[model samples]
Target: MAWQLHYTSARRGPTGRAGFQFVAETPGLPDGVRAGVTPYLSYRPPPDAPPSPDDSELGLFPVSLLYDRVDGRPLLLRCSYLGRDYSGRYGNFFAHAVVAEPDELEGVRPAELWHAPHWTHRPEPETPVLESLDELVPGAALDPEALAAWLSASGPGDPYALLGRLVDAVAGVLGRGHGRVVLVADDVELVARWIAVVSYSLPVAAAARLSFVTYTADPDGAAQRLVGTTPAIWASAQHHASHASAFDLRKGVRDGDASRFARTVAGCWRGPDLAGLDALGELAPLNDPAQEAAAALLALCRGDATVTAAEEGAAAELLSRRGPGIPEWVWRDLVPGVPSMGLDLALALHERARAAGAAEVARQCSLRVTEGVSDALAGASALAEIAAAAGVAGRAGVPVDPAEVSAAAARCARRGGGDLGAALAGCPGGSRDALLDGVVAGLAGARERERAAVLTPGNCDLLYAHAGRLRAVPVIACAVLASVGRRRPGHRIPVTGELLRLDGETGGEVDAALGEVWSEPPSAGECADLLDAHGDAMARRPALAELPSRTFTRLAFPGGDGLTEPAALRLAERVREVMPGGRAGRDAALVRAYGKAITAGPAGAARALADLADADGATPQLAGEAFVGAARRLCPRPPAFRAELLAALSPSARARLGARWTAELPGRARAGRAPLRGAEVGQRNELVEVVLRLRERGVTEPALEAWARAAATRWLAAKQLDVHLARSPRLRASLRDLLGDGPPSRGGR
Candidate 1:
């Protein structure tokens, strides 16, 4: 019964026209089978499934079995689909039918079964089962020529190397070494050993047969999952399973928990399991405790200073030493100051001063924050300046004597409202997780929902206008220097989440670096000084000009809200200066700062668009493309800004864009050359999108549209076209919808 094929080829619905059919066109088959069979459908349940109806108690299902002929006997392929696409609405999702040649087939499970066995003891569906590949490829023999061809074609690593090792290991175990074999287990470690043993030999294939069974992956497939490696490889690879586990937190280095796991399992990977590989399947991941600590520390550094390349490298260098995870006690102590004012931080400082006869620990934490900032003078202190509220400069912003600072602190002790000193008095220790959560939430909150202070007396008050979600200064100030900086040519440096071995000798250097990173004590004098400078800058700028964007740590709306063309361009320059060395971090910060900076007024934003249109930086992939999106999100009149920007292109850019692309199209196509790229390409694409958007608003300028169309035409007409744009059917539809362009009739990019 298990081996028998069950398929229904045709069925009709309430309307005769609503019919279904599946007719196999196989050759050399007997007429014993009937044609035009009834349809069979596996049911799919909605996401919010209700209780089964009475008729659904017995459920409806569909299945197709697979077989191969051997010695005139039908050998069951036992192929099954292991998963389903959960993309669309529930039901058969017939729109996405899955049927292909056996070799090309991926196993997918049937849709949801409405009924379950009344008995609770029934085996739950989709649990991994051990199976043998030998049964499918029995009495295996290899063609030496074919084997040689395959081996020569295969690379020495990854997919190819792993396959070779696995086959070799299996062949060795079968006593057919240097010959043929194939490769599974439930005991993870033991199974890993079994796989390792097979790696020493290789296998040969004679002929292949393919069949498929369908299985939909349940959302919780990991509930009782097992390794998909077959029984043969698992048995063979057992020889090479033992080695030191990679740095286990439980047992530490020499224990070899992960190394054993990898050599046993990963190193033994042969091919997809006979039961079918679940594309959606996931392996339970292991981690190195030290790497986790470094990641947390990286997040800490990004909190305050706009993380820069130098700072990032320094922090990475600190972590690469791998002396230790930031002790759990460190987090426990730091959490209090992170979300609230550093009351507990100060208390700890005082206590440590008494107990250790020094205040180095708290001093280190303070120093970490100060050293991260590359430009202390330029950094703003909104909290300090605003709280000080002195006309030209806030209280903290003035160059008062140290006596005046002490007097102010005493007054803060009494009033205790928004004052920094008052907030720090008796610092509270909040839950560690809560503090961590707040820090994370604050990370990307710099540019969020624009709560435009429309009703405010002064519309240009950028501070209150673009005021971001408030977080304690300490939360931003406290940082962790992740110092695992290693650079090898052609190797990309990882930003976070990596665990590499640290030379044991560097432990002292690691500690010293960590100490230096956090060594500076919090100085009220310095913070006040920063605020004073910021206030002075703010006071000099007219209140009616721009959003009050200057802050204690960094300038927000730099060059005032009515930013000049140079200042607008300098925004990208500022982004370039504060890049995180890594492209991803830099792009995110660039987009974020760009969005925040342009939100104040349309005057500066228009010029910013021009600068961004000609942007050059670390993230050429995003280029000026993202600035368009960021500006749109923050701009009050995006369409108008676009229109204004289109009216003025930099001379070089305008000439390059409106030149002979169309006239040279034929020759360019013959030569398979692209028309434009880099800044020009990005700017061109941006113009097209903006023009399309403007057209949507019942507006169209002939020159603007012509320019945009020509740019789009050149991009589409490029001889060596990008595959994504080339193959996209929706490209025409999108153009028609957005810009009302007809389909390209001939060769294209």
Candidate 2:
């Protein structure tokens, strides 16, 4: 697409008005005509006008440049109707042409097109550099001078892409009404070219509203020069600056210095400002896992960094890695969902984790910290929150400094005093128990005066109370004892049944601040006995549960005289121990079920019996005892219900206790009272009848036989026994002493 222009001839009319001629080589001209006027330009010299530079009677004309769409290069033409006369009807009107140097072109100013009257009176302004952008950029208007300057400095690469991004950014900044943007690039020349394109792309008036500055070396001078009233400023830099509002342009370019690069960007006043963070993510070295992980730290620093779903995934991946470059703020921000901690400790943890290559510990610690931090935040005490975070770290299998925990706990105690229970309650799950221990240790180490203030009788009671509800935490119980010793030097905590006792000032060397008191751990029997004597008192009063060394203690023990379903269940785990072996053990199981039956309901007793019978280490005899106890307690039940209960037990247990259970059934049915005449007599007969039916089904034993014979004798004398018993040969044989001489002799009645 070679583009050129030349003067072919000039003609003068008889009236002394000259007409010029020129030939153009513009390929693909409309209708295939290559010669015509371009730039829609025209000129008319005065009658006394001087000859042109070629001395052929032609003068200079100012015209805007045009770019070929195929390649971004400038083209010039001289004609009256270059594009308008594409049909060649006016081809003979072409004017002679002359090309001039840039300075020479600038020297001669042209009147504004179609506004010659205004320009004719006023001084003609310098030739406004313009370009026909319709062919190259559609509707865009290009500043020829600015485009020339930018193209010259843009070096090697696609500068147009950068131009598009800069234009969008400037448009956004303008819409925002105020903004501070810094464009980061490789060198000063590239930065300058980008700024030039962005500044001139907008309408001339709108472009004047924004200020542009490019800082290379001297920041102080640049800062001074930045003083202006412009609502928006777009700055560019080749290097990092701490105060810069930075946006990196090094997208998709892994430089291997990502860690250092990211750190510099992160240190900026507004962090990375979201402009090129995605690009920086690509800049991270893919070959080095450590460097990639390190690069992520800067992104994590921004609160709003997770701008996209991909970013969220990236954050998760980075967090899963073992990066040694973790900063202190990350740790501080992790706990309590807020940032407030010194760098030394967090830095130490980072170093330690880095050395051990245990990034998983950090990951787990962060998760656990978040899980428990909400409760601490609700507790409204920063110290308690810190302690809770430490506890969570411990739960996550991350080692935390004892001093840190102690200090946080001590501060919490000092601030909260008697409200320690409330504070502990605010912590969730394991963190609650963990924070409790720390509070005890921390308070114990305090001066006697300070300890006394926090461990006042009421406060100790409160702390002890909190300890009780906890599933397992011994230090809190010890702290209570310690506080008690301080108040009453030799007093022991009074536990029912004497299961646990702590003497003040024991001879054994111990932490005196913990009341210098100690007690031997109780045997399982003692703990069980204590729970039995207490009934639901432990459930009602948490301190009772906490007072015992075993944090797992609950109110229910099996052999209690008045057992409850809850008690039976609380001791369910230790059922075998409660009813060890032998007949005595069986009797104890019966007693437990009996107590539960009396207090609660038959259903509850049955459940308890089943649990006891099925417990590990339970003997067959004990199981039998439990079955009999549950069935006997359900006496006077319907026949079907009694059968169902018996069937629920193992075959051996049913066989062992069925007889004893049947023997008790008759008495239980009558409610242990003799039947009277009339309906009472009928009811008595029915009870014996049911027993007979049970015996017929092979459910009776020797005990049932003995009971049946005795019951028949008593019923006979009172006329409550059914005389028809003589009909059944089996009953007649068993009750012969009461049924009389014969089986009624059929017709003797």
Candidate 3:
């Protein structure tokens, strides 16, 4: 009752032949024993050469042990072939062959079997079960130096890192309590490294429980399905177990069927056909959550079918569980469809992404949440969540939307009275002005009553507290003052020094508002009227001295007469310190008024004039001219007053005025005023200097001939002129030619 078996090798071509040679008659040594020699396949035949029997049977192929009907003995048909080695090169190949039944193989099981070409003398080595590294390396030591070296050279596609991932996938699959696992990979290096990693990295129990298989290409044929179930020898990696069935992606299996399962492929392989599984929508479980999630997300991303809510939830859960290790492509595929997948899934992924320190992924998730939210409160809440996440991410060296953070804070402040200062504090430099503008706009929308409540005299610190930047604080403070003034017309809105010194748009707005409310009086009315209206308020805000140039000019020199009004002088002085210089075409009228005020002889008038002259340096000529004109117009009745005022000026000031007065002499002479006549000694000296200057400029001979005619009639009658000629040798020298020997005395006249 022994089974008879035989093996044969053949080739087909013009020079080739096919024949079944009787290699052995087998009453096999044991079920695992075989008879025959492995074929030589190291030298690959040319593509046009006839196919050989050794090349035909390269991988795990199906076969059976059949019982003979008459003899009651088993029978087998044996064929043999060559397969690629683990390294993928067709050299030094291990042989695979099947011995058939010649009177049936004795002592061998009369059941279905999977066979490959092999030599009877070269039995395949058993895969070593590895429970710990100690089984492979001494003391279970991890070589840190080797590891560091590898990592230094390793990148995203590093073989070792890929191997690590595959190992993790294997452990994950085995942890689910599957008794059998099949790994399929197209790459020789991946397959080889996977084998090594399994033995060296995985526990013995896990490694021993798994099975692996390889495939052979049939150029002109499809794989034949075996009738009965049996353990298949998958290359040298499969375990000799009766329950381990050969994997076929086209085969159907029930969910409860533990007898057969090909759960995952190690490399790129398609999932099992959906129609092949008893569960209608269930795909073959992937080896790891990351892969499973990526596949599921990809389905949604591709729009291949309408994904239900349940499927999206399942994918989100998978992502959360395996987020840190998931490849970047998965996120790239998943994020685009996140909005339609529901906010809950996005939220779940957001947390997972942030935890994994994938900042951009987290930001994308948060943005998707923002896009998905439809309700106002919910939108605001989503923005708040984004802002909070941004802060945390910022500290972690990750970026989120700072603008969104600012917007969220502003919204929250509007809703719950929160401080916007905190929201604005950490904004980047480029964003500060934009955030400040938002704050200002938000404050401007407040109710009149609300503004009055917070914009009180004592709440200046509140302005700084919420205004974010120092320059911006004044803007907001000034705005609040203007708004409160408009609402409560008589409200004593105290503006801060910051507001007074404000620049930019805020400064202009505040100044315009001040002019509108405490307006400059018309010139017909005295400056006393303006003082009566705004003096109390001006007194209350001493910081008014620091008002912006335009606002200071408006309040200090209202009606162009306030500078000279004794009643308005204190208020004028208070704001005068901050007056803008004349560069931008301001300060001319103010200078004139100020000069007139000085002539009025109010206390500190001289100091005021000096301050004005310094402050309006750009208009020094105008100021000097104004002072000289004012002295002439206002000090005429008391001629000595002019001398006193001129002496009180700085030497530079006096020089400027003297030059200006001398310039005016030609105009005065054209107006028929006596250019050489003056009431005060200083005035007389200035006129005498003008005449001496004309003489120096070569006008002496003509001027003396012209003046000699008028000198006899007008100049001799002028007593001050007579006295100057009596003492001043220079004055007498010029008139000596005109008077012809110091004549024309008072008696002669």
Q: Please give the CA lDDT of all the candidate structures.
A: 0.29, 0.39, 0.39
Any idea how many clashes model 1 has?
79
Show where candidate 1 strays beyond 4 Å: 1-222, 231-358, 368-749
| lDDT tens digits, residue span 657-706, model 1 | 22322222244322334465444444444445555555555455555556
Pick the winner on lDDT between candidates 1 and 3: 3
Query: Candidate 3 regions off by >4 Å?
Result: 1-165, 169-289, 292-539, 545-656, 659-734, 737-749
Clashes of each: 79, 7, 24
RMSD (Cα, Å) for all candidates, in order, is 36.4, 19.9, 21.1
lDDT of 2 by residue, 1-749 (tens): 22234332233322333443333222333332222333323332222223222323222211111111111222232232121122322322233222222222221111101111111121111321222112211111223343444454543443434443444445455555545455554333344344444433333333334444433222322321111111112232223433333344443122232233333232331221333333333333323333233334344444434333333334334544434444444434433421321222233333344455558545544444444444343343544456445544544455554444445565665554445655555554545555566567656555656656666676676565554432132334555655554454334333221223233332231233222332332333544454566534433333333333231122223223223344343444343353234332344454455456434443464455556555453344444444455545554555444444444444544454455454654453334344444555554454455455555555644444455454555534324354656466675453454335644222201
TM-score of every candidate relative to the true structure: 0.16, 0.27, 0.28
Model 1 poorest 10 in a row by lDDT: 276-285
What value of lDDT does candidate 3 attain over all alpha carbons? Answer: 0.39
**Full ranking by lDDT:** 3, 2, 1
Give the per-residue lDDT digits (tens) of candidate 3, residues 1-749.
22232333323212244332333333332353232222211122223223432444443332121111222212222222333333433322222233333333322222212221122322132311111111111121122233334434533344333433444445454555443333333332223223333333322322233433222222111121121221221333344433233332223222331111222221111222222221211222323334344445546545434555566666667666655655455566566666565555676667776776778877887766555432222355422343334443433343444465456534543443333344345444444454444445444565555444434433334344443353544545665555444444334323323344566556466565554333322321222333344434433332322222333244343223333544334434433432323231244344445655455673345554555555543344434444554434433323234334445566565455444444444443323244333443444444444444444444433332343334333443445456655766766565455446554554423
